[model samples]
Structures are given as structure tokens and as C-alpha cells.
Target: MIDPEELGRALRATLAGFKVPRNIEIVDDLPRDDNGKIAKHRIRAHYADAGARTA
Candidate 1:
């Protein structure tokens, strides 16, 4: 469980007045590329609005 509130507090104090990010998605690990680089495209897909789901 990621604490957005506490995270915001630390970030706010660090930056000192920059608006905190509203949607903070905390993940265990980020997608990486073959060369050991961050796969930004995969990250975007993961967060994409897949719309509402129903059981």
C-alpha cells in the first residue's frame, strides 16, 4: 500500500510549494527495455484508462 498523503508531504517539503501530483500510481517495478532502459511506452499502456469493468 502506497501512502500518497505522506508521499505528498515529503515531496511538498522537498520542492517547497510546487503543486502535488493528484494521481499517484505506485508500482512495485517499472517496465524496462532490452538494453536495461525504462520502457515508457509500456508504462503508458499500463496506466491507460481501460474503462469500467464488470464481473
Candidate 2:
């Protein structure tokens, strides 16, 4: 399995310091829309619910 931190490290090495993501979520598959496109809004909504539902 790939370590997200190691991958983040590699990314940090290649990208500008400001471009690194603060948190890297390792989901089995990213949510997609009916048309099979990446759903950015869906991802955000899922993350947004992480704490709310837990709380």
C-alpha cells in the first residue's frame, strides 16, 4: 500500500511549498457524478460531514 505521507513528501519535493494539501484522505474510490466525472462538490460535502456526523 502506498503511504499518503510519503506521496505527500514527494509532492512537496516537486511543488511549491504553498501547494501541498493540508490533509490527504485515502478513500478506496473517489465519489463520481452520474456522468462519470469527478465530483469536487461531493468530495467537499463528504469531508464536511466527517465531524458533524461524528459529533
Candidate 3:
């Protein structure tokens, strides 16, 4: 399995600090809309509290 921390380290090494994500979540599937597009609102709402805590 890919290690999220290791991936984060690699990204930090190669990308600008502002371009790196503050959080990493691994899921089986993302919530999708009826049209099969990613449900961005749902994702944001779901992770809202987590983001708040981190911030």
C-alpha cells in the first residue's frame, strides 16, 4: 500500500509548499452526483470539521 506520509514527503520535496495538501484521505470511492461528476459540496461538508480542527 502507498504510504500517505511518504507520499506527502515526496510531494513536499518536489512541489511548492502552498501546492501541498494539508490533509490526505483514502477512501474506496468518492461520493458522486447523478451525472457521475464528483460531489464536491458533499466532500467539503464531510471534511469541514476535520479541516477546522486542523486549522
Candidate 4:
């Protein structure tokens, strides 16, 4: 299995600081659109809902 922390560490080592992401979320699957493309909007909304719940 892939380790998110290790992946983050590797990214930090190889990428410019500003280019690295601040958060990482591993999921079983990504939401897809009718055309089978990744549904980024749904992903954003899902995370937004999660953040709101926590706050």
C-alpha cells in the first residue's frame, strides 16, 4: 500500500515548497462524471461539507 506521509515527504524533497499540496486524502474511489472524468466539483463539495461539519 502507498503511504501518504511518505509520498508527502518525497514530494517535499523533490518539489518546490509552493508547489506541494497542504493536505492529502486517500480514498477508495473518486467520483466520476457521466463522461467518466473525475468529478472535481463533487470532490470539492464533499470536502467542503466535511470541513463545515468539523467547524
> lDDT: which candidate is best?
4
lDDT of 4 by residue, 1-55 (tens): 6888998999999999999989887888999999999999998998899999999
Candidate ordering by TM-score (highest first): 4, 3, 2, 1
RMSD of each: 4.1, 2.4, 2.3, 1.4
Q: Report, for every candidate in turn, its global Cα lDDT versus the true structure.
A: 0.75, 0.88, 0.90, 0.92
In every candidate, how many clashes are there?
0, 0, 0, 0
Model 3: per-residue lDDT, tens digit, 1-55?
Answer: 7778998999999999999999776688999999999999999898897779989
The reply for model 1, stretches above 4 Å from the true place, is 13-18, 51-55
Q: Positional deviation of 10 in candidate 1, in angstroms?
A: 2.7
The per-residue C-alpha lDDT of model 3 at residue 2 equals 72
**Cα deviation of 18, candidate 4, in Å:** 2.6
- Compute the lDDT for candidate 1: 0.75
RMSD of 3: 2.3
Candidate 3 clashing pairs? Answer: none
- Candidate numbers sorted by lDDT from highest down: 4, 3, 2, 1
Over the full model, what C-alpha lDDT does candidate 2 score relative to the true structure? 0.88
- Candidate 2: segments with Cα more than 4 A from true spot: 51-55
User: Could you tell me how far off, in angstroms, the CA of residue 19 lies in candidate 3 after the best superposition?
Assistant: 1.9
What does candidate 1's lDDT look like per residue over 17-44, in tens digits? 6476766767798889999999999877
Which lDDT value does model 1 have at 10?
83
